[model samples]
Target chain A: MKLRKSEDSENEVELNMTPMIDVVFLLIIFFMVVSELSTLNLEEIELPLADESEVLKSEKLDARHIICNVREDGTIRIQGNSYKKEQLADYLKVEADAEEREPANPSNPAVPPSKLYLTIRAHKDTKFENVQNVFDACSQNGIYKTRVMATKDE
Target chain B: MIARLLRRRPRSRSSRPKAVEEAKLELTPMIDCVFLLLIFFMCNLEFVKQDGLIKAFLPKDRGQSTGPSVTDLGEVRVKLLWCAPGTTIETEDRDVGEVVLKIEKNVYPRSGATPDWEMLYLDLVKMRDIRDRSGNPDALPVIIDARPLVPHAAVVGALNACVKARIKDVTFAAPERPF
Candidate 1:
């Protein structure tokens, strides 16, 4: 094979397409993974508006909390996976059982409570009965620490 | 010799620039496609909503109440219910509001007039002050009880009111429903 050399040796540079394409593909993959991971625990639900709400504090949002999502149709979801009402009860029971229960407060307690917290994200249009079901399930499991999610337009 | 050189055309030398052009890859199309993808991903990315949290306390009736719930406590109960039909109420969000906001004994009926949640919040603050004067300020647990048909927005609205009132002890009433 005869190599064709450019007579004026300025080295006619050939831009490599392989590495560029590789980087582009890697970027696409990165975005895909990041978007999926970011939205794993959250659902696309319209939160109710709150007149006055405190800004979320990072210390309050620790890794030990469970994010429970309730859709308008009363479907319960955890980590993007949908669960039935009975299944949710069973799930909470397991979580509650896993946590070490603290001594019951004499001032207001009938039983010892678990320290596990549950954050409920319910759609604004959802029926109160749906939220009640979740609240009841958490309470029955001894997970009394709970918070409801809302958004402020301002 | 001059005649022979002239007859031999300088084709390769004349088209050397064309050969160089062919040797280099055309990056414009690929770059265009890459930019399009970047724009697509950037536009597709959704920022999570700034959701605020309202803490809630749920009661567990395991057996019996121990000591009148945190010693002597002045409890405030807020009940929300769906309004009667034909009572057209529109909230600020343009949602047709039907939630009746009741704080203590004063009732803000959802009967045609818009129920002011802000007013209910103020009443809770006043009641909380009254309880504070009696010594158990932190023990004034505001229970928010809503009917089944009431929307979650209504419940959150009440919860928001309680939180804004700085009532530390807030509970959501999940009373046993009569089937």
Candidate 2:
């Protein structure tokens, strides 16, 4: 009689943990995948500072625009090479053509538009003529959206 | 009659109650989850934020001419005028100690004709050096009066030199020309 009672008590103490552990492991995998897709390029470039002014909101991605760095000593660097104001229009025209052919999605037959957005970084002491040349090139190339890079005032 | 003989008799004492199982917390898995979230936020934060260091002084409205006098008493004004190959810089309205011309040079040995950027840089440096030694560094604001025909790249070059010299205040005075 005593042996039969002990066996019945042991059978009633069973616990189920499969469902709880399944939820925890699912959350871990989700976060791991999201972290991988949010990486961005963090390069060091000097941006001109502006006075107290309202911020201009823009949605253009960095890859879609041409970045030009104008040094204080009248040196125009486009993608790391020195260029004169007169040479900018021709160079940009070639770049715009190349961008049109290299579609972001190769599977799609439709090509992306070759609209160029220019981001200019000028130093405080730079001559007005040097900065003006860049603006002229953009207009000549049919690129209307020109943004001057400025640091936020704190 | 045989089954009854094999069965045991019940005890006269009362039976004891069954006890419940104790619940305990597991912290190892929870700790791992917390660490993963911490790493995610750290990587996404932008550390080196760029902000504007220079302040621009806009020209006062012509209607409000009584606001303040526009003078070079405590500021350094650089007026840039465009000239043709043989045209003199003094023909413009502004006065300066000297005027430098930026002409294209041939730098490519193979092509025999390439634009040289070194001369432009040298001229800018000399201009900045002259401005720095002129007066009190903190009191003087650098004013750039650009000609309409000047190239945009030249203006950027001049601005870059001011930044290199750590001049925080700059302004643009546009010429009276129909755009």
Top of the candidates by TM-score = 1
Off by over 4 Å in 1: A1-10, A60-62, A98-112, B1-25, B42-46, B59-73, B86-97, B109-114
DockQ of each: 0.40, 0.06
Q: What is the C-alpha lDDT profile of model 2 across A103-124, one tens digit per residue?
A: 3333223323345666676654
Give the CAPRI rating of model 2: incorrect
Q: What do the candidate models score in CA lDDT, each in turn?
A: 0.72, 0.49
Per-residue lDDT tens digits for candidate 1, residues B7-123, read: 343445565666454333345776688778866776667555667887775654442323344322467888776665454332333244466666656555443223577877888
Per candidate, the number of residue pairs that clash is: 0, 41
- Across B18-119, the per-residue lDDT of candidate 2 in tens digits comes to 463333455456547655665554554533354332223232222112334454455555444454333433334222212333322322122101112344
